[model samples]
Target: MVRGKTQMRRIENETSRQVTFSKRRSGLLKKAFELSVLCDAEVGVVVFSSRGKLSEFSSSSMQRSIERYKSYAKEKNLKHRGAEDNIQLQLCKQEAASVAKEIQLLETSKRKLLGESLETCSTDELQGLEVQLERSLTNIRLWKKHMLTEQIAQLKAREKMLLEENAALDRQWKEECLQHSAVSEEAAHDDRTSQHTEVETDLHIGLLGRGRTQCLLQA
Candidate 1:
């Protein structure tokens, strides 16, 4: 019969757990010894029990091996951190490029909606087109209203100017009429004085003629 594979979680029963720990520890130490002997390598292993008991295997001086391991770990961490930083920089660049492309696409869509382009627009874009058109129409109405109000204000100003001009002209006409009336009255008075003087002179001449005729008849 074939044995099934064992799962790697902790054994729950206290006796079973202790038995498993002993067997695994011995196997691990044997493997470390064999690796050092066969390959002429520096080998080190450390294990800790649940109760904090320490176990270790080393092919050479344990203290020297631990110091070497610490230096190797520090150098490896530095190299790996540099590589991770480079990777993060590349990711940031790619993300920026993607965001720029998205902004460009949005700008193109806006231009299309503003009547700057009709080509390449699809039925899929129609939903956004309606919203754009509504906003455009509202702006157009406001602009038209502003222009109309300006025109009305200009007309009102022109009306006021014309009324002022007409009033000025009327006042000038009335002044001229008064001056002409005075000139006419002065001319009429001069004509009446000249006519009265001429009539009196003619009557004086007629009386002299009658006096001369009566003196001749008496003689």
Candidate 2:
């Protein structure tokens, strides 16, 4: 008898859905194991249930397999990158040339502002360069002021942190010193008590001997 095709839809009944998931998951894992054993192929599988429970299988070390896969992908990418190497080199060269040209223009403008190369400049161009140079100097001064302000703020924050750390260390040292002083006092008290006890015992013995000698003389 030909079995009817199962429709590809979610089972609305909760129990039926759960049962179907369990059966399918077991079959999938069994097939994976069979493939690994029969074909001697490295196989890994991971499945998550609707409840976020995980099931995993690996024929060999999963970590080794993942690293091997990454290596293969990296090797493929390296080979593909070879084709673009020349294009990247050309772009880098073009960028370098652009930067060099800009530097040369800036150097010429600087020389003109420093009273050199002014022989070729017209009166209008010289006035324009003077105004441009003043604006640039003003911008530089503003930038320098901003940078100094930022540095001062950073230094103040660092100084505050250092002060707080120093205060904590000083407090800790004071506490340790107090503890040590208390311990020393306690030890000194013990020693003084012991010395007093020894002196009392010796005096008592000496009085007892003197009393015995007086009794012998009176007799």
Candidate 3:
């Protein structure tokens, strides 16, 4: 029988500590053996003393018992993990289904927003939207027409200005040519008159000198 309450702390005395360990080790091995025999369970236990000595217990051959225990524990862990994975897979499927439903609802809402829910639309609403679209198209066409008309008017105005400028330049050029021709003619006439005047003055001087020489000979 256990005598007293086991202290929670480690025993400070080496002798007490060794005694406690020996007692616990014996008890654990005995319980393990009884459990295997009565419950048809497999068991394996191993211990290392402070001095590096090995002790072990098993219900069957130690290798067989240890292998069996490992196999049982592995199967239990695998089964538990598989169950958890199945639950997670189910949750994922449910979430995916819910997300798909949400996406469908959003798609429907978007269609409605885009005015594709014709069955739910009233006649007035449909007519109003149609009228608004027609008015918008009319406004756009009118803007295009106005732009085209303005562009044509601007081109016509530019053409008219160019024509007027061309006419003015032609007229100015003709006037300049006429003025230049008239000035050239006047310069030619002035040159001929100056030449004739010089010839007449020379002839007069020659004839006067001859007449004076003849008068001196007669005297």
TM-score leaderboard ranking: 3, 2, 1
- Runs in model 1 lying further than 4 Å from the true structure: 1-111, 114-124
Model 2 per-residue lDDT at 120: 89
Predicted candidate 2: what Cα RMSD to the true structure?
Answer: 21.8
Tens digits of per-residue lDDT, candidate 1, 8-113, equal: 8979999999999999999999999999999999999999998899999999988999999999999999999999999999999999999999999999877887
Q: Model 3, which residues run further than 4 Å from truth?
A: 1-3, 38-40, 118-219
Descending-lDDT candidate ranking: 2, 1, 3
Model 3 compared with the native: what TM-score? 0.50
TM-score of each: 0.46, 0.49, 0.50
Question: Candidate 2 lDDT, tens digit per residue, 1-219?
Answer: 999999999899999999999999999999999999999999888899989999988899878888888999999888889768978989999999999999999999889988898888999999998898999899999999999999999999999999999999999999999999999999999999999999999999999999999999999
- What does each candidate score in C-alpha RMSD? 18.5, 21.8, 13.0
Residue clash pairs of candidate 3: none
TM-score winner, 1 or 2: 2
lDDT per residue as tens, model 3, 91-165 = 999999999999998887567556787697788867876787789789999999999999999999999999999
